[model samples]
Target: LNMANMDGDETFESTLLGEAEEVFVERIADDECILIRGTKNHSSASIVLRGPNEYFLDEMERSVHDSLCVVKRVMESKKVVPGGGAVEAALSIYLESFATSISSREQLAIAEFAKSLLIIPKTLATNAAKDATDLVAKLRAYHNSSQTKKEHTHLKWVGLDLHEGVVRDSVKAGVLEPAISKIKSLKFATEAAITILRIDDLIKLEPQKEDKKYGGCMDEE
Candidate 1:
């Protein structure tokens, strides 16, 4: 599909999207290729993954499938969370602020949890071979200032740009995630961690010997 989308009034406010009909795989000139047929609704594309080995193509297929699923999720959800650790960084900031509200020892626990939350971004920075501690400190400072100024209310997509080692707007960078998936993952992770922590059982099982097959009968005799 390569035409402008028109309404009943023929106002061309949007563009048509492409879709596929069928794909045929064949060999051409001793090389593999794919033939794609376009649908009436749109168009089609053919991708032929080539590698030096068979396993490489299989891995490429898996990678392509994962990428397609991610794109589909992003399109369907349309609710974006920061991909470059912005959401986790924001959550950490909120949690730390929330911990300060409680006067009980639970506040310390909450604060610890908040600290743990920063581990995600910190680890990300570390994995990128950047300065994790420095990034984390900068992130906290940025979030704290934002909280005080309420900048987050206006711009809520701040994240640590590991590539540049600076705090930047992730939304503008197009680093996003499906909000539903992101929130659900966080919820499930918290629930799972709490469930594991509350577990106090240590019921170890020991191997038992088999019973004598004819012992009861011998006693009767």
Candidate 2:
């Protein structure tokens, strides 16, 4: 019973009876037997027989068919390939490096790594707490000073490359194979910390200090 324009415009106001008056006169031959109640601005109802129902149903079916055809034509006109994998791979690498930097106990290395990863857009990044913790554990185990120092040198280089996308000219010049070799030699916390700091100058992180208890020695007079 309520009618209004979709755009909220007040100017367009006309009763349904006023619009359908001509159609009703043309379709209906008998007017004396029918008693119509309600004004032009009020409510109205029309009963359709089975034949009219079938006609309306056919119209609806045609409308749906036409809509689908238009949609298919539009889609065919534009050939688009969804590049989800490329984006996913790039984001995975970025997030993995970010999490590693965050959980790193080596302050200098972590600081540098964080700075580099922050440059990437937030939409392309993942922020999972578990991943961060795991990365920290990995860094701690790989760069332990107590472990064999010589072997971890290569690992340190690889970690640096992953964090900052930077590596020695020799590694770059040698390409993927030589770079892999250099990465294999990195070992020890000092090398890891140094490499991280080299990439990010602001990573002035210090190692964990051991707690030393004071034991007083009695002075001999």
Tell me, by TM-score, which candidate is best.
Answer: 1
Clashing residue pairs found in predicted model 1: none
lDDT of 2 at 111: 50
List model 2 lDDT by residue over 1-221, tens digit each: 34446776555444332532323223443332344444355465644323256688678777777766645644654432112112222333444455665645665544554444323222222232123333433443443421346754443322212333322222333222222222233234346766665784454679856545524444457
lDDT value for model 2: 0.39
Q: Which ranges of candidate 1 are over 4 A from the true structure?
A: 1-34, 43-46, 151-155, 203-221
Error in Å for residue 181 of model 2? 26
TM-score of each: 0.71, 0.16
Q: Rate residue 14 of model 2 by lDDT.
A: 42
Q: State each model's CA lDDT, in order.
A: 0.77, 0.39
- lDDT digits (tens) for residues 17-70 of candidate 1: 445587788796567767767666543445667787889879999999988887
* Model 1 collision count: 0
Q: Over 4 Å off in model 2, which ranges? A: 1-130, 145-148, 160-221
